[model samples]
Target: MAAYGYFLSCEEFSPSQLLEQARMAEQAGFEALAISDHFHPWNDEQGQSAFVWSMIGALSQVTSLPVTTLVTCPTVRLHPAINAQAAATSAVLTDGRFRFGIGTGEALNEHILGDAWPEASQRMDMLEEAVQVIRELLTGEQVTHHGPHYTVQNARIYTLPEQPVPIYVSGFGPQAAALAGRIGDGFVTMTPDADLIGRFRSAGGGGKPVIGGLKVCWDTDRDRAVKTVHRLWPNEQLPGELAQVLPTPRHFEQAAELVTEEMVRKATTCGDDPDEHITAVRAYTDAGFDEVYVNQIGADQRQFFDFYRTRVLPDLPRSR
Candidate 1:
């Protein structure tokens, strides 16, 4: 069955606001939640970035919906061992309603510790090894290891959930998706691309869950919504590997200046029309995604939730 979730954007919101959003999400009939982990906002215009672990702890207290990190990089800024410990504790806090989503990570977040950013291929290798180490530690056993990218010495996670935490791997293309199929508990991707989902399953993903996420702006004025997205998330429309390699918020801001209002309108569903919002979400369901998370890209969060609750959510195809 397909489940709908809400996305909590750490870069755009404070920890307290996120907790409130989680509560509102459950009230608005969202079944799950996805949160982003960032060291810095995509650009200064997007503003705040909070520690995701602390926000996750708070989310566990406020809501019962299953929570997953949309994608966290355990390879660089933080060691896999520490990530394992954090994930274990979060599983306990959420009372086992937790999924750990991981990726190769962007330079904007991972390069903070003065670590040199490796090439994309090297980062992918590191991510795979990191997942291996984290899975071992999540079993509540002592782990000692040395790998090409990371090392763990006699580390064990004492606090763990009763069941194993599911680790979902995120990717943008076939190479990383194939790795996810082989090593991840599930798969995560940003687009509602059916071909990618098909590739993941064919590459040994089998019956594991595939999660997708996208942003939408709900307002009476479509033009205003477009401008809002243009101002706040032009980073979303960047092409190629810019999102992965950009090292600072300022760099992203410079890059995002190239994004036009038309691009934001073309990429995200904006405005109050229930039909538009419905179509945006149905794309994921049609693509065979097991779970889909929607992010409200502007300040009209309450309005967006109300729109979903009273109009959009009820009309969505239930069986897809």
Candidate 2:
């Protein structure tokens, strides 16, 4: 059994649209919310990237559902200490319902500061150190550290929630899973791979929650929906480390040109089939994920919510 949530894509929608979707998600019976933290859209047609911390503040005023960044990178572009403060403030604003989801991050966002992009292994080391720094700062005690990747001098977060913010670490492979298991309060990934979940548990994540998500297109016309996904999110089909290494939206667009509509159709659930959507989500639950988030790829969000409210959610297995 798992709790189902809606994923708010900052890469695809405006801040106002995201706030409205948060409201709609709660109203339509979603149990929680997952929002992407991106400095830029994957492609131009996606067209929007709001500062996620500011959007979180607005979300606090709009919805009562718990929110998690799915996820943010604390290792580059911004120091982990700065992110700790932002997460602390977000936790307070959400009344202790914010889950801090973090990762090693992608070059597309991290490279903007013109810092040399580290290799995968080095980035992993930096992520471990960044997580350590963030956790220490979240305790609200003054912290002074001279680590391999970061430096903090008597730094402390003045504002924090009554409970410490739970940090969910994201990973897509065995090494990263082991790191997440050893250090994370919870684990985040986009796929529902039971073997990966087992790897996490074996590495010491046994009692911690596992979170995953997927995207779908809901529309009256299946072909049109496929085209919408092809145009707006062909980047999703770009395989391997390309997503983590690509430096900019233009580069992503260039890479996405290799993706085809047939590929998008094969990978995503498109059109108005409730059973298809239900089955897509069930994959996560079946793979032992504690929570699963679903993102509607195109602009039919209100309709998607309504359809899920009436046709999908009631049929899914509940956590209880």
TM-scores across all candidates? 0.98, 0.99
The local distance difference test score of model 2 is 0.94
Kindly list the per-residue Cα lDDT of model 1 for residues 188-300, writing each as its tens digit. 99998888888888888999999979999888999999999999999999999999999999999999889999999888999998988988899999899989899998888
lDDT of 2 at 165: 95
Off by over 4 Å in 2: none
TM for candidate 1 is: 0.98
Off by over 4 Å in 1: none
lDDT of each: 0.91, 0.94
What clash count goes with each model? 0, 0
Which candidate has the top score in TM-score? 2
